[model samples]
Target: MNALAPNLIAFGRVLRRAGLPVGPAEALGAAEALGHVPFSDREAFRAALRATMVHRRDHFEVFDAAFDLFWRNPDLPIRPPDPDEQPPDTFPAATRRASEAMLGASQPRSSAGEPERRQDAALTVSDNELLQSLDFEAMSAEQLSEAKREIRRLVLPLSERPTRRFRSDTTGPRIDLRATLRGSMRLGGEIASIARRRQITRPPPLVLLCDVSGSMARYAQILLHFMHAVANDRARVHSFVFGTRLTNITRALRNRDPEVAFQAVSHILPDWSGGTRIGEALDRFNRLWARRVLGQGAVVLLITDGLDRSGAEGLSEAAERLSHSCRRLIWLNPLLRFAGFQPRAAGIRALLPHVHEHRQVHNLNSLRALVATLSADGRSHRRSA
Candidate 1:
């Protein structure tokens, strides 16, 4: 057991570098687990280490690749393969990343180290491109952390809506009678110059209604990071999470730090990762919050998978009311990521017609597309008016 300790510790470091959450504690746990299993049996050895080191479903692939490369060639150093040596698409993203980490550990230092570093940097850029399209449900702990950082930089630029109030403008289309008269009075009633004004325009309020049911657990967590960023970036942003019941989390998410805001949310939320009751939750929001937050032509973002537990009862009416109350009601469903997805579920059929736009919220690319859609919608509204 003492002889294998150094090898196990090095393997743990490779897993960590490959973006698994393995640490010294997990390494110790693996060592203890291996004691019970026969070391000579390769399959048993792999199983024991896996049980101790891997916790997340998404980490399994990377862990397996790292384990194979490290244990099979214990003494041999593996250098990164040249990009042209093999087609990049032949390897899975997890395998590719694991190979890179293992190579970084064993590659010998050379005088021409600058080129090697540049190649590693290029590989990193490639990894980020792949990450943008990766599903939130498939991301490992490290990837999810990186995704959160990317989410923070996302800007939700809503369309500017005209208000009844006016502001002074030099090239105004409409003359300001009140301001013109006031200015003439200052010139001894000579009517010297006409004052001008233009209608004031500002971004509309944003409302987020997220589902935190059992099936949507992973997506809800990632979307909350996005909601936190949006809430802090602008005013009049309201956020709510619902499962068996609705909870207003607008105030909780307003905290500057994302970690603190999520902690506050968890403390207040009682029905997270529970059963879904879309109809009842929407009804509650309509009665308790619609009048308060759905003012000033607000844009509503409803994030859910549309798997209702209550058989869609009263959901259509509630959705219709919500759509009418806001300037635009956008339904963001993760299920839409499937190419063959249909509104076969009762909840989806009930709510589909009520929404102005139905979009996917499963990946970072989808979220970026959403921002583009909103900006385009705002511009169209301005042109049409």
Candidate 2:
């Protein structure tokens, strides 16, 4: 008989409700992955679920919560809680100590005369500890305000990649015959070196389409900090806000300090907490702003909830046109953080077909992932039914 594992499918549902994009495929993946993990330890189980179930940054905390709730051993005898009692952030300190002692009962040493640090470190990731403990969903209004300030300080700065320049050693199919012949004149007509035309690498243009509509208010504020970081550090990054209308605030967010840039953006963006008209916004961007920003390997990041009040056909056409204008068109939608998410929304369905990469942007962890994804050239696999 197969041993009964924790109901991972039910756990996935909990994560989805908590804002993790864990769909049926990911649910199945998590189940299959759990088989490889030793289910004897809570930490091990947590690791397995995180690796298989969570993809985007924003969903990390939701996954953490679901894992914590799912792995609780209800069969263990315990006293009933007081009516006013609340659950602890984690297991009791005494329980944690006992668990640690049990896990650390055995130790291994390396042949190089060093104690192995691998086992303990794997179970306790510092980033996870820092981010997972903070409950973003239940934060008080004041705490949320402070969290936004913290986000501003740690966001990554965007730096330009060095471009290809003419080098003597690099062989190209098109040779400069005239230059090669001219050099050979000094060496008795022996063509040994050649001068070739080459292009200099310039910083790629950045175009950010940030959604500032009603549904995205909380995340939008946080993401503006990220945008400010990128805009201040990079010379060619353009920023635009969309709600009922599109407003280009690239100039406003170009201030040296992220705080100042965000302040300026706040002043200029009058449509905060308004309705989302993604199609109309994209239409404006394509018709008027595309040629201006879509130059020199530009990458466009479309940040929104994919909740369009506008019609689907308009969004599809506009998204398609926007995709064609950029080197890479990445859709950074916060809604993707939910588990069991599907492209069922009219807006989501229409826009997905045009995006080169549809990634999640919900928290600091996810933002860090975006940095890695952006710096590297590997393509993200898009799933389609």
Candidate 3:
């Protein structure tokens, strides 16, 4: 075994704790890769480990921070400093979480071979507050996990629409002649209590069309958790994801457990992280699903960065049709997180005019804004009715 083998193994555990998805095989491979590179060349050693352990682009920042902290003191094992010893603002949220994960994973060992310190430092209340405004794309794995829990608590209330069906109510505007006759029959063939009824009301259906192309992959994963929560929270909620093709994951997301639901979604989606074809995907939905799911005044949520690989071919027509079919068509773009964002993209320009509202959805606060927008829209609708 290489002299550095044990250290490499320990480093993998820290990465996993910090949410990098590193495993024993990756650690062994990294150790072997390190042997070929000169230990004196820090950059080469870091690159070797990174190439072997890091798989996703979003994970790069977390891996780098973990590497720096784990290898800071080579002579000693990885032991993060006390949270009070270092100001939380000094490091980025990702780095702070990485440090916390490291501190929790391995404790300091004494020269006298005393038992290791088992203290764990947790993120403070201020850190949780900061996470609400943090962009989903910039979040580390651990932070994303925390964010998912928060997302599950989000409520999406819809506007109630009256239906043709009626239910009994004492102060109802319309008299129920059939019910009145039945009551009279039971009252010794004499006139009895008059029955009244009112039209039934229910929340409108919600349909989500999310983009899962390479550009939107980071946002898509987190939003899926949000979608799962919404799906389980209400009835008549439909979810679909599109990249090069459109996939209906409504049934998959209906699973009560978010993790299990995501697993089912991953197994079925064929175009995940693939190229985008917004026009084609939208066209398909309008043709195949609009009539079926858009009935009864469903509200449609179109979530995408609007970067169509097809250069907006047929996008305008599809967007117009989709907007006409739904009660309200809301466009949510993560690109809106940028202050200088413009509708310069062909897809963005094609879809903008057809949407009822355009909003940003890159952070927890933005999501809360979405909830508020829907609630306010519901109230306004009630007043208009």
Candidate 4:
């Protein structure tokens, strides 16, 4: 029983490394709770560990896996001591080292006996590829910080789209008569090589309309980080956030540093986590900012949950107009993470038909999907949002 407390503490640390929120306080509480439950009772022990440590629904599996690994070892190296014998400090450095191994943090031990720490190993895995699929909202604080770094590293594969405007090219399909005549004159009036012109290509403009309503609060922060990365990566990215009204934050996101940019955004937005008015917000956008940003074959990304407080009043007409104004309208909803999701909401149904594509935006995996979609050359289909 004397040894149990220290082992439990190390177990809690292992859980923390496994992405659970268990910290020092919870570990102390679990140690105290073990005094009440019978030591011989396995179910009670498991119940006490779970009740004190696990918090969110998404974290339950992670906690369970950690518990199974930490507590259920059949061949634990240290055998129980004789009742007359006692060890100093209950659990020694060895058990904690074993806990680190069970948690997959099996790094080299330092001269002082603790596992050697790396500078930024908050959620370090043997293979870093797994982090790409980890859900952003489920990430712990240290993991979130690491994810912010990864977010900045993300590259946009924005393909250059062709424009109607033409430029002179020798291999072009269309003949440039003026250039042909000029070339002949330069060659002393003799008939010379034909001059040709090809259509000019430019990256299509990206217009982002993000929702900052209460329903979208969990994802809005990370989404803003993503928006900032994309905005700074290229030119012609117009950014706006909507709650009860539309507020353009393109200039705010233009700042290279996220901390500085979000500070400016917080100051600019009067309703950061307010009620949704999708229909009215789109109406406002169409009336004011549509013409300026939606030119030259712009692509629109509408990031929202589509739960309008106004019940989508006049939203269909507004969405139709927006579709016509932009070359492609892609709806990115975090709520689509649910496998059983349906577009039953009046707002979603109204806006669905107008969007060229509807996609999820819950995690890094989903964000990668959006980048992949953009990189593809096929025409985006008109579909449900």
Q: Largest TM-score belongs to which candidate?
A: 3
What are the per-model numbers of colliding residue pairs? 0, 12, 0, 1
Compute each candidate's TM-score over C-alphas: 0.69, 0.58, 0.73, 0.67
Go through the candidates in order and give each one's C-alpha lDDT: 0.85, 0.68, 0.84, 0.78
Cα shift from native, residue 210, model 1 (Å): 0.4
Off by over 4 Å in 3: 1-12, 20-125, 187-190, 378-385
Where does candidate 4 clash, by residue pair? 352-385
Best by lDDT: 1
Off by over 4 Å in 1: 1-125, 378-385
Whose lDDT is higher: candidate 2's or candidate 4's? 4
- Residue 331 displacement in candidate 4 (angstroms): 0.6
Sorted on lDDT, highest at the top, how do the candidates line up?
A: 1, 3, 4, 2
Which lDDT tens digits does candidate 1 get at residues 1-385? 9999999988988887776667898899999999899989999999999999876443566788888888988688776667799865466656776777787788777776466443446535577898899988767546777998999999999878887889999789889998889988887888888878899988889999999988887688789989999999999899999999999999999999886687688778888788999999999999999999887789999999989999999999999999889888888999989998878889998998788888899999999999889876442221100
Tell me the tens digit of each residue's lDDT in model 4 across 18-56.
545578888888887888899799889988888777653
Comparing 3 with 4 on lDDT, the higher-scoring candidate is 3
Q: Evaluate residue 369 in candidate 1 and report its C-alpha lDDT on the 0 to 100 scale.
A: 97
Could you give candidate 3's per-residue lDDT for residues 1-385 as a string of tens digits? 4668878887888888887667887887887788799989999989999888876544566788888888987455455456798755556656866776677666655588677788555754577888999988677657888998999999999878888899999999999999999899988878768899999999888999999898898788789888999999999999999999999999999889765677688778888888999999999999999998998889999999999999999999999999889888888899989998878989998888788888899999999999988876442221100
> Candidate 2, after superposition: displacement of residue 243 in Å?
0.4
> Relative to the unseen true structure, what is the C-alpha lDDT of residue 220 in candidate 3, on a scale of 0 to 100?
87
lDDT head-to-head 1 vs 3, winner: 1
**Model 4 poorest 10 in a row by lDDT:** 88-97
How far does residue 5 in candidate 3 sit from its true spot (Å)?
11
- List CA RMSD, all candidates: 8.1, 18.0, 7.4, 13.2
